[model samples]
Target: MEIYNDHKKLFTAALCLFLLLTFFVAIGPAFTSQNNNAPLPGSKPLSSLQTEGKAVFIAEGCVACHTQQVRNVEMDKVWGPRPNVAADYANITRTDVWRNTATLMGSERTGPDLTNIGTRQPGDDWHYLHLFNPRSVVSQSVMPSYEWLFDIKDYAWPNDVVVNVPDDFKKGISGKIVASHKAMALVAYLKSLKEVTLPDGKPVPLFLYGKTAAEKAGGATSKGAGTKSGPDGEALYATNCQSCHQGNGEGLVGAFPALKGSKVVLDDNAELQVTIIMKGYNGRVSEGYGEMPPVGTNNNLKPEEVAAIVNHERSSWGNNSKKVTVDDVKKIIASFDKPASVAAKK
Candidate 1:
């Protein structure tokens, strides 16, 4: 009887310990959930178009070739933003596609990271051209063309000239359209990419705050309206903009213009400065050697950062102008959607 009682007590103790361990293990994720800063679902939910496109991406076996994650050390420096966290995957649940399996979490970088491709390359026209023929833009591209994915009819030219055959499209099995609505949806999904902001509600390198010009300039007495300034502006310039523009703001002659004494920088009208920053400059028809690619393509910059940097550039390097504000940047972005005549007037 004594032996039986001891065994029973031992069994009960073991069972209680097991239950307690399991309870803590189960609730572990809840406690750690705050640390997992996942991305929110995009402003536009996964539409039927995007859903179909995702199906196409899966069917085409593109995941086998391409990856979405960006590692910390390997490609992070060049790519600007690094691999996403569990929080970045939160929005995936909203799409009903939690990508938990076969995710691009491997070490090998077979292709570029697609984490922020959508935000990095925002222009639809650029995407369309690249998809139609990769070699057209990227001279050393090794990827196969998906010309079949696109419909020649859908891409009618400006003059209503229906060109039945696109020049780059190679003949395939029965010449069936491979570029379906799914392809576009996939593109939409890709384009929706954006870099996760820092805890302070700004991008990693740049910091922004609401300040008048007077406050920024150390309470200088004379000014039309107060402007914003801080050390972030100078730091941002050094990290990103300095390489091309050079340290002293004297750009490569006949390539990048000298910011130190440029008419555009000193202009009283801040619109020109805002326009050039947002749209960028192509010197193809002009005198400069290479096009000034859009810096926003980096996808790490917020609208306010862009404004701050522009404001900094205009006000610094021996140039001075009315400070550019976040509101000003928002206004310029809105102007992009307006009619050409209205934009020109603005």
Candidate 2:
């Protein structure tokens, strides 16, 4: 009996020591006088709206579904961003809120990652519409509606009279009481997401510029590539073409053909390039890599903008050619009604 009691006493003492050590260690860090050296990228201090939205997010158990920390391999390649570092967490408060380290690690991805949600789909109108009714916009979305959070306002036309809500949104509330400040705040938080820019304040892999290494290396001949297009053309090219073709015009090998010495860009005949851009391409002619979809599919780019991009590609790359005017594009578009075989034979 004495031996058992002695063992029990020793076990109690060891347990007490362990508890004391854990308490001290946890409290020491909590009370430390260290300054935060890391700052959030592209983030100002949390605004009142952001703070409120964050509270709402927690209250609604959003963290249970969404994750903010991107994994390394997921970051470097597919996601076009890096994993969250300790510095990235510096701005996030660790008090009543879950600490970046302890909140939940390796949690299942039940919902889409919210780490880069802000920049993923940016548009105030889009967010407003989506929040009003998820099923209205996305036929297959499973997200619950937070309609109570928003006030709906009647649409006003140039005459300043109220317009009826569209048939699809007829069930939705109308009037000034239909929008939610909380929803807007949450959307704002999501729109603020962006990958950390490089030390030089530029995106990584540098090929985004579409310029060849020789052009980047101060080669005098390559200097005027994208410059001749002027600001409008340059902007159009940057947004539409830079992703695949890169800024240097070297393109992504067989995936995207090089504009630097492209026969299509240099040829006096503009039909091939214009047709490909307008209607898109498929078949073995483009090396069987699959079809190029119509540029206007996004619905954001205008016909004039498409012409500008074509002009920029033709003029900017190493294959300097005569500029393609909007009038030329319009004429080509008009002629497109005829069959392709006939057009090619001509």
Candidate 3:
């Protein structure tokens, strides 16, 4: 009874209670979560270079401006095909033994969400140029140039990776731009950020408030929702092709070739257009424009999604051409068992 009445004893008892609660409520849950949340099915661990690049991503304060999450909202639809889920981030590993950046869900969206950037713009050249100088690709971008990641070489060695910077952004530097090892690693990290597919039969949480942009585009979800229509071509183009092709379909002068009134775009042979979208086209790489990536394969873009994109391109930018159906695009995808790699095609 005397001990209970003592101030020191009471204070000690209160402190013990607080610690007990903390252990049970916070610490216990953390350990349990670690045990429960294994990496989602089919999630790939980051490669060594990508892990190094992730450290670079954190070191450069990229997290301050950019985000990795896509919130479940109608507006955020522009950032990704579907809203982000816990499973999407279940595979995050520590940056190193010394420190863990944890998941780079980020603090805010000062730039854009990088959830599906790998799928959205898979072009290696585009990423390289953008990293070196944001304004090179996006004229109105406010991102500072990371020119330190590159070097100006009088002539690149055969094995060296030469960056074909646009003349205007080159600032009269006479040498070809060679990417440093760190730069290559950083680009590899960015390219490896593809969206993982959910296992079959799992119901997706629909984005709140309205019909999806895909729905508006006369398309449905990639998961086979609203299969009566194709996916939204305009949205898909904006996500996957707009950076290189530009919003108006007129590509960057001297960098990317213009798609407005393009002969291939206007051609009746939708097969060529579909093949280019799926397998990528480098036929014009010799003309200074860079090679396109196999966006469809990389992103796992479905037949309906590909058709929708083709339709949007064929109809947009004052170019009117035949629009292929989902079935047509499916046939095109099936025909090419082998990759139409830029090296092989060129």
> Could you say which candidate leads in TM-score?
3
Instruction: Evaluate residue 94 in candidate 1 and report its C-alpha lDDT on the 0 to 100 scale.
Output: 35
Q: Sort the candidates on lDDT, descending order.
A: 3, 1, 2
lDDT by residue (tens digit), candidate 3, 1-346: 8868899999998999999999999999998988787666888999999998887887788888988888988888777768888778878867679877658888788788888887777788998889878987777888888899898888889888788787778878888899998888888888888777777887776888867666577745432122455465777787778777788998876568877999888989777777777777788777777888888877778887888788788888898887777888777777676586333453
Report the lDDT tens digits of candidate 1 across residue range 269-295.
667666666666664424524555566
After superposition, which runs of candidate 3 have C-alpha atoms over 4 Å from their true positions?
A: 1-27, 212-235, 284-288, 299-305, 315-327, 337-346
Judging by TM-score, tell me the better candidate of 2 and 3. Answer: 3
Best by lDDT: 3
RMSD of each: 10.9, 15.8, 5.2
TM-score of each: 0.50, 0.45, 0.79
In order, candidate lDDTs are: 0.56, 0.56, 0.80
Candidate 3, residue 70: lDDT: 85
Point out where model 1 deviates above 4 Å.
1-22, 27-48, 81-83, 94-107, 152-179, 201-342
Per-residue lDDT for 317 in model 2? 51
Task: List the lowest-lDDT window of 10 residues for candidate 3.
Answer: 219-228
Name the lDDT value of residue 126 in candidate 2.
42
